[model samples]
Target: MATTFIWPFIILQCVTVVVIVLFLRMFLHRQLEIGMGRIKRMDKENLEKEVELNDRLEKLNEEYDMKIQNAEKQADSLINMAKETAKKMRDSERVKAKEEAKRIIASALQEKEKVLSEATRMVNSKAVDFSILILERVFSEDELSGLRHRVTKEVTGVLFGSDNVGELIRKNKDIEVVTADKLTAPDRKYILKMIEKQAKGKVNVKFVVDKSILGGLILKIGGSMIDGGIAYRVNKAVLELREEI
Candidate 1:
């Protein structure tokens, strides 16, 4: 009877162990299903987030590329502008330099002309003075006197032929005669007689001797003067020479 009771107890314990094992297996299967669903959901969310991140990255890269292109274009435009500005400045400076050079050349030419004119004037003046001195030293008194007589005769003829002779004599009662040397008594008498004949009236006569006449005669009547001298001729020649040069 004891053996039969031990066998039944042993069978009951085995049945209890089997029921607990089945319940534990069912619980473990439900938990496994929940864990699988959570894992699938997390995987799907991670894939979406990765796709979004990729899209954002692509957009950011495009924007960066566009910005880089714009920056390069701006840099190129600025470089071109700077180059153009420099070219303009260089051209302007060149023009200014050329203008300044032209002005300097013009000023220098003017100064050169002024200096040449002054030198020419001085040279002509000295040449005339030297020629006068040489002529004065070479000609004797008698030779100079003959030359004076001839010039005086010509001047007298011209004066006598003029229509204003009577008016000149009437306007000025005093007649002044200039000569390179003192006239001889005969020449003086002849000149005075000629003057008195033309005047048709008596007049006071004044005679002046100036050796600078260079063997010619000069006549002064009131404010009018007749210059028939070698010096006057030389000065006129010099003026003509200056014009030619």
Candidate 2:
């Protein structure tokens, strides 16, 4: 009975030990599983945080790209604006230059006209003065008066240019004559009456005192002013100069 009781006690003790070991192993295994589950949860949470961070970084990069694109557009716009402004400036300068050139040309033309007019005036004055100098030198003192009167009459006639005042004496017409004062009154009247008979017209006389002819009378014939004086002969030399000019 003691052996049997001892053996059963020993067996009971071994069984108890086996049961305790099994329970311990189960607890340890359960603890290990719980630890692995915690590790997995932590890993998931860490992964989620990493994904969020990556998303945030991507968003920042997109924002940066948008800013860069906007900056580029602004830079291009500025460049275009500068080019347009430069072009406008250049155009304005060209227009101004053209206007200046036109003004200069106009001024030159006006100056040229002014100089031409002055030259013409000077030449005309020279011609008139030159004529007077030649006339003064060629005439004698005594012949000068009679020649001047005859010349004056011719000048007046040319101005009037009446067709009736023709140089030729015709019948039944009024006659005009230029003569010296030295002609005697009765003799002149007789000569006039004779000329009237020949002319078939009334005679009117104009008198001039002239010694330049030395002694000669001038007769006005039809359409002709006859120069019968020495002074006129000298003046003919000067008149021939008209052909040379």
Candidate 3:
């Protein structure tokens, strides 16, 4: 009877221990599964947060790149504008300089022309005066007398050699002769005879004395004049000198 009782007690004790051990194992496994689930949920949340943060960083980077590109473009535009402005300014200055230079050159040329004109006028006047003085000094009184006679003879010859001497004398009806000195009675007679021969009739003869002729004869036939005077010769020389100058 004692042995039977002891065996039943021992079997009951072992069954209880096994039940406790199995209960402990199931509880620990449930707790472990809950911890594992919480860890997985935390990992998913962290991964989602990391992905959102990466997206934000990418957006910020893109905005920054756009801003940088815009800044670069603006800088380039400003540089180009400055260059264009500088080029325009340079061109304007060049044009102004050229115009100024042209104006100076034109002014200089005008001044040169003015000076030349004044100088030419002065030279011509002096040349004329000098020429007249030289002529007056060169001829003596005796030489002048001879020159006057020769000149009068030449005038008579020229008048006689004309194609229509008689017609010219008749149309004019008055022949004016200019001399530096009064003629002798014989010289007057000779001149009057020559005039009548050319006129083929009686003609009026007018003799004018002008010492300014220097010593020569001037014959006026109609509206024409034949000048063979020292003064006139000097004037012709002055005119030629002016042309040469």
Task: State the lDDT of candidate 3 residue by residue for 1-245, as single tens digits.
Answer: 99999998999999988999999889988999999999999999999999999999999999999999999999999999999999999999999999999999999999999999788667756766686566558977677678777876776677666767666777888788888889888888888888888888888889999987765677788887878665676667776866896
Query: In candidate 1, which residue pairs clash?
Result: none
Q: Score every model by TM-score.
A: 0.51, 0.46, 0.47
Compose the digit string of candidate 1's lDDT tens values, residues 135-226.
66888777766866787677667765676765787677788888777888987888788778777878888889887775456667788777
* All candidates: CA RMSD (Å): 9.8, 14.0, 11.9
Query: Candidate 2, residues 21-51: lDDT per residue as tens digits?
Result: 9999999999999999999999999999999
Error of 1 at 231 (Å): 9.5
lDDT of 3 at 197: 82
**Could you say which candidate leads in TM-score?**
1
Model 3 RMSD in angstroms: 11.9
How many pairs collide in each candidate, listed in order?
Answer: 0, 4, 0
- Please give the CA lDDT of all the candidate structures: 0.81, 0.63, 0.81
C-alpha RMSD between model 2 and the true structure: 14.0
Using alpha carbons, what is the TM-score of model 2?
0.46
